[model samples]
Target: MVAAAEVVACNEDLITLILLRLPVKSLLRFKCVSKKWLCLISTPNFSSRHRRLASASILLSQIPGLISHLSLNCSSSEKPFSSLDFIDDSAGVKLLQSINGLALGCSFHKLGKPRSYYVCNPSTRQFLTLPPPNAEGHDSFATVLGVYLAFDPSKSPHYQVVCVRNCSLSAAHDRYQIQIYPSETRTWRLCGSPFASPSDIMFETGVLWNGAIHWISPTGATLCFNINQEHLGSMPSPPSDEHWSKRRFRYFGESGGHLHLVEIYGPSTTQFQVFELERDYSRWICKYQIDISPIVDAFPEMVRDYLHPHHHDSLFYAFVLLFVQETEEGSSLLLHIPGKLISYNLRNKSFKEICDSGPKSTKTNTALHIGCFHAHQFIETLASV
Candidate 1:
């Protein structure tokens, strides 16, 4: 048998073919093997093959509720999918941010600095540590969340992660400008001046969707941070409900190409509202409203004191919410077979989910930890196409 190390070290042409044929997880691990391997995997050819193989695996599995969280390189020769658990990542991973297929998680950090977000490919399990953006001597934004990460595979495969900067005393809708971290240059750059945004965000309530980042501003509008232009725009408003509060933007998730929002009703009776972005948002008239509700009766055992509003724009329904008068119980998760992380399609009213993290997985607190990412300039073609 040919030695894998020799195959990687000898020929560039064969390395591409071999690595492409290897399980995605293995390439993730090999990212640490050497700089050369890292460069090779980041290339366009390898990404395309990986996507092709990943698509094939998805088609084979018909389960639609689960999303692919990890795709490992298990064998030298990749083939059909198999029932395998490459890595058992726990919810405690502290997923601070996720964009494209990369997630930025936080672990305990010493030196008294708060834990920070690390760019990682959950499927490949390949991660790169990013230091905190320097805000020294300058006041920090009123609110902050990791937002928008976009990459152009054709152009150096360099990816950019957008961080919302809500400056104090700014009037431009661009008050929330973006700070971008480029993988190739390994540097951070602040985009154009602050776009218009509310002075306050109640709390950081935002999620990445359709190649852009979104947050619920205290001003009661869904604020969208365009990843391509780095501009700030408002999404369609919520359905008219006197009792509704935009502060509840915790469950932001992209599913079936549509952006879904979750709302928690803090009242005598508990209510969970799910909303999808307007299918035709050409004029931003699209809106999300209550889809599912009043679970207090059906899920009496699920006690959740969702008093504190967090970013609630996700599809995760497994976490038990505590009611003042009830006890807590485990909730169920959506299970899709062989899921792959795909972008949300606002026009199609669907977001793609992968085949990892089966329904049996435990509930997660990432709804609050989600950061943001900008859309790749390439995807901008969708607007015209």
Candidate 2:
């Protein structure tokens, strides 16, 4: 076999072929191959290509799987996830940004590792690298924690990105700090807000809809920030969960053309309660206690495969994605189990694993948190295991 170092110096096509076959671990090491390869892997164009491949969506593969997916795009797979797609794992994810298929990451071996680098489709065998957002004095404290990359579908193809930071609340400061980084400008603009701070971890378990990014605050406050409008505010709160261990950001999304949040019982981690915010300021309630676990009583043999296993690694924590799905009777949502890219139907209350048993070479786990912008794109932590 050709040495990895020699492979990097080869022509682009050969390098791309080798990358497509290697797993995440191998890709990380390949970064040292050469400066050019490093630069190539870090570009925005490569990210878009990578997204298309790993999702391996057939544009038309009739996998009885994702059948439970409540996505509005549930029809034929003919259309790609739209050309311009921006994906980030959590609202609190500062260092990672995925836009138009490219994932940008902040790399710092020293003090604060701000969002500086970007990773393309490690699976697509392409990538691009951009300079860090800023090389300022506060580079130690300024962090790109949460990201929102969006393209306007109503108008011509257009996209924007927002990188937020929570600075310290000193005597001179009362609210948290936020920063906006638009791809069109390639610069960071500082904006002080009514709420935000460096120490706070804005819960990712909120909703992103109508041009705003939402989050569940640590103290149970429903928080939201508008990326286009550049404003911070709060949404209405629901009743408390009796169980505290499960007291994390549950799933929040827009369904049937309405804003919604799903609250599940903690500890039990089985039952899910749905809350929909209405125009008049009232909530629509729908609750379903799902033991999607492998408990035989919960699911029969026919649908057993839909229930996948989380890695046995004790260090890893698993969070289930429960979003609103559309149903024939009314409207519904489904739960997306990590590792297994399948969406569990809330209507039938059944799960369908996308059974494309092809070898997948992904940059990160499939179970990343869900967002509103597009499919297979969500906010995730950058600190690798």
Candidate 3:
């Protein structure tokens, strides 16, 4: 009996080590193996190690409540869509942004009024519905500039949810309202205004980097809000040869903890230009200008028949720039072209098609049917909301 117990203890230690390296999704399932195993996997130390080893995926959501996840590694075997079970079907859930494994979701009522906001950890299937902000006078027209999630459960159990509201104060002027909700306090309060003048914050392409949330204004300036300090700042955007009004196909994103700007232009709409902000955010440096002519040349039939000659004029209505992945293999850009997803590798100058099979069939879909979809960088974590 003594010898058997010693062997069991040794096996348990070996199992724990092996499980620590697995992804959070697998660990969540393994928790049902035994009570002892559940306790081990539920530890803070185990959760931290699991997060470090896990890779980030891309979460894609379509209008009218369709959510899916795609692996960032571009694994073909991965399912195109993994349904989010935590969200209720009746509730109209719209994902705002994701940070440190926690996603901020805005749920609207039947009449389209601003409802409650939920911070959810999709991997762990845990979520917390935050108390609604004080919206006494603010109505549905109050533009939600952006919803930022400031949570890292690994460091501390507490988290914060910030909502940037831009409303019309006058015909020519706008008011910026900053609302903050801390987990510890469980209450929402108006922090303060972050902008000096009436500025239109681009919420669709907001990127969180360097402990701040950034958005590009119509004037070609990057608006920044420090999450920790709750202060606002502005930085210059990338230089443009054409007028600011003429340059429309620009997106703000982050890669390798650095902010990047992607501008797609040219007559054929095959020119891809990427810029990286300096460490001090003073100026922008042109990283690369990839000519996608090789890709277009490869598929001459598709380019000649399907590709629009003047796509650059209405790029947003046609194509969406998905997440950018910088890996050991190479840097690649994921782009949503109508019904299909294409990946362009910067190193090899090659383009590969990605599969997008969701709950409904996409074989006969078109650009109009695909509509507007949101994609975010998603990392699996055992963090609680």
lDDT of all predictions, in order shown? 0.44, 0.44, 0.68
Each candidate's number of clashing pairs is: 65, 38, 0
Best by TM-score: 3
Q: How well does model 1 score by local distance difference test? A: 0.44
- Among all candidates shown, the one with the greatest lDDT: 3
* Candidate number with the higher lDDT (1 or 3): 3
True-structure lDDT of candidate 2: 0.44
Better of 2 and 3 by TM-score: 3
- Which tens-of-lDDT digit does each residue in 81-110 have in candidate 3? 354446763567777777767777777556
In order of appearance, the predictions have TM-scores of 0.54, 0.52, 0.84
In candidate 3, what residue range of length 10 has the lowest lDDT sum? Answer: 299-308
Off by over 4 Å in 2: 1-136, 140-142, 169-175, 192-207, 242-246, 253-259, 279-284, 287-319, 322-342, 357-385
Please identify model 1 stretches exceeding 4 Å from their true place: 1-22, 26-43, 55-93, 107-111, 122-126, 134-136, 139-147, 152-156, 166-177, 244-250, 264-273, 279-300, 303-385
Show where candidate 3 strays beyond 4 Å.
1-9, 23-26, 72-81, 140-143, 153-157, 167-171, 193-195, 243-246, 300-318, 355-361, 366-371
lDDT of 1 by residue, 1-385 (tens): 4697776568888777777766566776788888998888876666755654442111111122122222211223333222112223322234444333444444433454354455656454446766566553344422454444554343434577677655545344435556887776676787777555455652244656666767665446667766767676777765434566445544455533466655454433233445557656543332323222333233332333355345344223323211011002211122121111222222332333322432233233223212121111000000000
Q: Model 3 lDDT vs. the true structure?
A: 0.68
